[model samples]
Target: METKKGNFSNDNTMESIQKLTEQDAKTFLNLIYAILKDNEIPSEKLISQVLSVYEKKIPRLVKARQDNN
Candidate 1:
């Protein structure tokens, strides 16, 4: 699931997203939606960047899930 230059592949992105809680997952998707809505970036190219941020945020949500557990 790893990639060069700290980039994330789609599979890695989905795996990271699956580790989040329901609410956190919803929030994550919402953030992506907001980015697409508010930015001038083209949808095709922006997907990778969105996935990168989504993957990066997974650790925090995972930590919070573990803490709550």
Candidate 2:
């Protein structure tokens, strides 16, 4: 039983959104670390702030991904 709405299906769940595989997590962390290093902003506080922003923007990100798919 699946319902569709604007390119999104009801099959999606919070657990799916929150779950990241170990390799994916490592890659994400590496990318973030590289960006911070390249931009000379390597601070734990900055990382926390960036994560906060990411969390805030997740809804928009999901919509954008759905639109793309």
Q: Give one digit per residue, the lDDT tens place, for model 2 in 1-68.
A: 12343222324433333554466446556766665666556577767655543443333445565677
Q: Which of the numbered candidates is closest to the native, going by highest TM-score? A: 1
Clashing pairs in 1: none
lDDT for model 2, please: 0.49
lDDT of 1: 0.72
Against the reference, the lDDT scores of all candidates come to: 0.72, 0.49
TM-score of every prediction relative to native: 0.59, 0.36
Residues 21-54 of candidate 1: C-alpha lDDT, one tens digit per residue: 7888788778878777867888777887676666
Score residue 48 of candidate 2 by CA lDDT.
Answer: 65
Stretch of 10 with least lDDT, candidate 1: 51-60
Error of 1 at 20 (Å): 1.0
